[model samples]
Every structure is written in C-alpha cells, then in structure tokens.
Target: MGDTFSSLLELGGPVVLILLVISIAALAVILAKVFQFASARVGRHGLVRQAVTQWRTGERNTAAQNLIKDRSLSAALVRNAMDAIQMLDQQPLSSQERDIREERLREEISARAADRLFALASWLKALDLVTQIAPLLGLFGTVLGMIDTFQTLQESGAAANPATLAGGIWVALLTTACGLAVAIPVSVAVTWFETRLEKERAALEVLLTGVFTAGSSSTVAST
Candidate 1:
C-alpha cells in the first residue's frame, strides 16, 4: 500500500503542487474578505447606533459627518436614513398619519441596511463559485491523465506494463481527491455563512427599529 501511494504521488506531483498553490490563493482571498467584512460591520454598526442615539436626543451637536467617518456602505445607510428623518420632520402630516409615515421611514432605513448586508453576502457567493470551479478543474486534470495513461498502454507492445497504466490512473484519481479537498471545506464555510445571514437580517431589523423610534420621538417633540 505504501509503495503504491508513493508511486502515485510521484506521478501526480506537479498537478498536486499546482492545486496546492491555487487552494492557498483562494483561501487567502476568503480570509481577507471575511476580515474586512467583520471589521467594517462591527465598526459601522457601533457608529450607526451612536448616531441614532444622538438623533433621538435632539442633539444639535451631531452632524452626519461627525457620526459616520468612513465611506462604507453602512455609513451610507445611516446618512440616508438621517436625511429621510430630516425630510419627515419638515412635513405637515397629522398625528393619525404620522404612524404610517414612521413605518415608511423605518422600511426605507431597513432597505438601506439590507443593501449593505447584501454586499457583504457577495463574498460568500464568490467562495461558493470557487467551490464549484475547483471540482471541474480536477475533472479536467483527470481526463488529461487518463488520455496519457491510455497512450502509454498502447505503446507498451505485447508486454502489459501494469505499472505505467496504474501510475496514470492514480494520477487522474489524485486530481479528483485534491479538487474535492479544496471544494468541500469552502462549500461548508459558505453554508455556515448562509445560515448566519438570517441572523444578520434580524440585527438590521433591530437597528432600523432604533432609528425609527428616534425619528418618531422627534415628530412628537415638534408636535
């Protein structure tokens, strides 16, 4: 078994190495994207909550510029919501209609939040694409290896060269294994993130609630 494995490795060494390099590259991209998403999400969510608090308190001291520092999507959402709140504040809608107006404002803010979160979800989709691509690449490599094995068999004359055919077949199978190794882990991670997406949607709903409450309080204060 050990000798068979060693011979197989020797046959597919170059393909295995190439697969390793590609897998490492894909893993690095995924890690960097995840880190960026996490950092921005945490930072921007905190800033949004702070801005909502100040807006609720009727604090004249808070500017959107002062509240949201970066050009992140989350910051854009908060800025847009604040603008909506300002516009609503200027309206002459009656108290009975105010609740409907408040619900509209909340939905608008939630939409902004969903858009930002959707951008983050794109990274997971990219990882999923990589998973799908890896297996196809492995299959291509296997097909090429099989072609080479059959050629070697035809050239062997009357003497059946078992070792040559076995080596080629092993090389082909190894590509499949290598491809699956990269694909399985990536797909699993994508699945995990997919499940977490609903949790994130809930968080955005909560944040929007806070923003709407703040907006409604402002309306009450003016009345």
Candidate 2:
C-alpha cells in the first residue's frame, strides 16, 4: 500500500497529493450523505396518505399526533399542515378568509419541505467543485512535468539522455491520469446523489399535495 502511494507521489507530485486529499473528502461526504438518507427513512411511504384519510374523518388532532410522532419527511409535512388546520379551526374567520389561510398554510408547508431538502443537499456543491476541478488540476500537473522535461533537455544540450526525457514525459502524463481517476467517480457519485434527492422531492410534493387536497375535501364536506 505504502509503495503504491509513494509511486503515485513520485509520478504526480504535489498535484496528485492534493487530488488524493480531495478524493478522500468527497468520499466522506458521499458516505455521510448515504447514512443521513438512510437514517432519515426517506423511503418510508403511506404516512401522508394515511394521515389524510384520518384528517378527512374528523380525527384531525389524532392524525396530527400520529404523524408528529413519526420521523419521515412526509409525516413532518403533514403534521405541519395539521397544526395549521387546528389553529385555523379555532378562529371565527369567514369562508373567504379561511381559504386564504389554507393557501398560506399550503405555501408554508411547501417551504418547510424545501428547507429540509436544502439541508440534505447542502454539501453537494463541494463535491461538484471537486468533480469539475480534478481534471484541470491534472492538466496543470502535466504542464509542470513537461516544463521539467524541457528544462532538463535545455541544460543538457545535444547530449540530453533519451531515457531521462522519457521518464519526465511519463511522470508528466501521470498527473492527468490521477486527475481523471479522482474526477470520474466523484462525478458519478454527485449525479447519483442528485437523482436520489430529486426522487425524494417529487415524492414529497405528491404527498403534501395529497394532504392539502384531502383537507380541502374535508372542509367542503363539513359545510
């Protein structure tokens, strides 16, 4: 293991070292996000639908209690909407005013959902930066190696060793290889993460919209 790293260091120099550190950091973020998503139980389904059914049955507080005790994102959003319903139910507002309150409540619920999504996606930009710059850094290393090779040839004049020139060229190319190595996997990871986040967002939107529609139906039935 040590020999392998040492060979990389010699071939790629400082740029390789920097790229390796960035690779490690990116991996950490990826793993941490995976764990976070797992812990969040984002995959849990049906909480919102069940809560909506209960809400429509005039068990509003009970529905809210059940959802509030859950940890999933869908549950959290439904719970917020339920809380708004409970508070609004206590007031003496007219029908038009009540409609306005529900509209605002819908916006508030969506905003909270977006905030949670943003938190999940926060460190992703750093991964994107690493993905973009890794190749450029590698190219920079290539340039540095070529410069050293030419400098050696210039100093040696006509007697420049062919083997020495070849070695310099090889080392110079190593940087580009290392850079691509660092970049490709990180880029793939970033894409996968974004895909998963989008799926979650889409699911949340469907669930929240369903809850809102259910609440509206309940209000219509009561009058």
Among the numbered candidates, top lDDT falls to 2
For candidate 2, which ten residues in a row score worst on lDDT?
A: 214-223
Question: Model 2: what TM-score?
Answer: 0.86
User: In model 1, where do residues sit more than 4 Å from their true spots?
Assistant: 1-21, 41-93, 206-223
Candidate 2 achieves a global lDDT of 0.84
Measured with C-alpha atoms, the lDDT of residue 185 in candidate 2 is 94
TM-score of each: 0.65, 0.86
Tens digit of per-residue lDDT, candidate 2, span 1-60: 999889889778899999989889989998998888876667676766787777777766
Clashes of 1: 0
Give one digit per residue, the lDDT tens place, for model 1 in 1-223.
9897566557666666666777787788678767766765533466666766676677523736555575555556667766676676678878778778777767767766777677667767678887998887777778888998898788887786888788679878888888899899988878866766666676556655665666554554684
Q: Which regions of candidate 2 are displaced past 4 Å? A: 53-69, 216-223
lDDT of each model, Cα atoms only? Answer: 0.70, 0.84
Error of 1 at 97 (Å): 4.6
